[model samples]
Target chain A: MERSIRSYSPKDTHKIGRRIGTKAQSGDVLLLVGDLGAGKTTLTQGILWGLGGTEYARSPTFVLVNEYPARLTLYHMDLYRLNSIEEIEDLGLDDYLYGNDLCVVEWADKAPGYFPVNHAVVQLEVIDDQTRRVTVSSETAHLDRLVMAIAGGADE
Target chain B: MSDQDIALAIDTSTRYAVVGVSRDGQSIAELSWRSDRNHSVELVPAIQRTLAQAHVSIEDITVIHIAIGPGAFSALRVGMSTAMAMATGRDIPIITIGTLEIEVHPYLDLGQDVTAIIGAGRTRLYIGTFKREDSLSNGHVYLEDRDKFLENLPVDSIFCGEAVAELRSELIGRLGPDYKIVSAPPPTRSASVMAEIGHAKLKSGDTTDLADIEPIYLRSSQVASAARRWPNTKTE
Candidate 1:
């Protein structure tokens, strides 16, 4: 399933992220794909906060991944500098990838082979300086509801 | 100690740049530091300090032992090239050991089957299993893939090595309360253990040809340059 939503400002983006986070459950792998500074980190922060996390979510570019404890555990990973399947495998990612946590991966293209079939992907494109067009697609049916919630909730 | 009994060993795999010197099967000196991407700068100096501390000169060294990797690519290259260069025309033998085995050796006699794993960086691992010999000699080692490694694990097995810290919870959860998990010592300690192994190999005349040595990389590198989009700049 696929849903395309537009956000004219950072607030709009955060609202969309919050809605998805609110609906997120265990064993959800969320792939966020976008260019640099396309609000990936901001959306992640919004999602984490919306999930009732006390600490702020930061881009895990240098550390590779960061874990957050909320109503659901969030595993946030950034793969910008990772270019190889070997590099990704050596990271011991399978220990978390298969676990019952909410995983959000940035630059999910770096290790495209590892993402499971039931995951959702959000492609955020910079339509203008402040506007972004996010296309949410997933093979799992529940993620369609997530996309719907994000699209509909943001307008309210 | 005789000059011929001095063995110098270096391991740059993983994040540690470690050097060890042993004489007559006994560890004499060791030095290591977290290289954190500074392998070339830190390794030679660390080796120099370790040899000096051991009261042995480079010219007196009879064997060069290296932990040829299933490790970081650049670090493994640095260690192999350095060891080869140090042994060139010096009549010194160079012996190589797998990095995973180095991590697995210390726990062989714990009376349990052992699973040693090192990170291979994707969602994969370079894993090996060992069963101690009846004479208390080191176990036979076999490298296995992560999924298969997990599937075929023996009951009451002990999981150890460089990658275990990240998987401690998962392994315990999977194997239940009966299994044991322990972290191996840092690279400096493992390099010393490797030196002892190399010394044994030296006494037994088990060694590698200096020219034929290579790192024990089970997986090939995955890097490739992007395809060209423009036509050739030079015309025929």
Candidate 2:
């Protein structure tokens, strides 16, 4: 199933991400594909907030990954600085991708094949200076319920 | 201490990292533990501790045996680089063995076809098939879906490796009672096995060049093709 939500501002994007994050489970992977300045970090910050994280989630483009403690541990990753698939493979992401935690990856398109079989992909497209389109797509039932919750505006 | 050649074996191919020291094909000291994705940090210390336990220093090491992986990429690199550095510093021979080979070595004596598996992220595995009679010729490793690999197992074949525990029920469901899944209760220390193999190879003057060794990372072509089958989610 797939769902698209339009964000009029960064706050709107964060709200949408919060909804998705609240419904995220252990071992859930959220792949974020978008150009720079497309509010990827904004969405992830909202996710961290929803997961009960106190600190802000920063872009992991340089350090590669950041771990945050919350209701469920969150592994935030970024592939923007990686130059090749070999580098990504060497990141040793299997443990985080398959472990008992939640992973949200920015610039995941850099190595699409490296992710697990079951995962949700969130694509952000810039519509204007103040608007963006966020699309979440996945075939698993977990993601289907997540899309439903987002579409229904179920904030609990 | 006797004046025998000492061999150091390191295997950080999976979550379990093992380091062992051997004197003429006999294990003197070995340490294996589950690393919390900190192989780079844990590996060198584990080696030092293992060598200390064996009452041997790094200079006494004459041969190094390392498991070149079809396993975790960074874990394999940690083991590989450490082995390479030690071998180069001592001007000793290094024997590179495949991870799957070490996994299946303990089970080869059963005289049955053995399949060695290493978990590759979610619901996928790195597997290699070994025929008992000609195990060396059939050690080609590849990646496959977990269910797919289990479904294709021949009757009465032995399945072994780190992945066996997680896939136990699936294997029983698919293959019934005819199959055997070997696990670590009677743990076959892989590093010890590597040391023995390295000893045999050293006796025959078979050693890998320090500059030429590389980890055997099986690519994810199968997963890539499966990803392509997903419905196009791109919007205009």
Number of the top lDDT candidate: 2
Q: A88-111, model 2: which lDDT tens digit per residue? A: 666777768877799999877756
**Model 1: per-residue Cα lDDT over B162-226, one tens digit each:** 77887777777788877788854544235678877888787788798887887765532222111
Model 2: per-residue Cα lDDT at residue B145: 78
Q: Write the per-residue lDDT of candidate 2 for residues B66-185, one digit (tens) a residue.
A: 999887777788899999999988898899888888888878888888888888766778888887788463676788877777668756779888888877788878887675888553
Model 2, chain B only, scores a TM-score of 0.89
lDDT, residue B144, candidate 1:
43
* Top-DockQ candidate index: 2
lDDT digits (tens) for residues A1-156 of candidate 1: 889888888888887888888988877789998988888988888788878887888889999999999989999999787766657756756546645678899987655545655689988899999999888888879667667766674567
How much is A121 displaced in model 2, in angstroms? 1.7
**lDDT on C-alpha atoms for all candidate structures:** 0.75, 0.82
lDDT (C-alpha) at residue B55 in model 2: 98
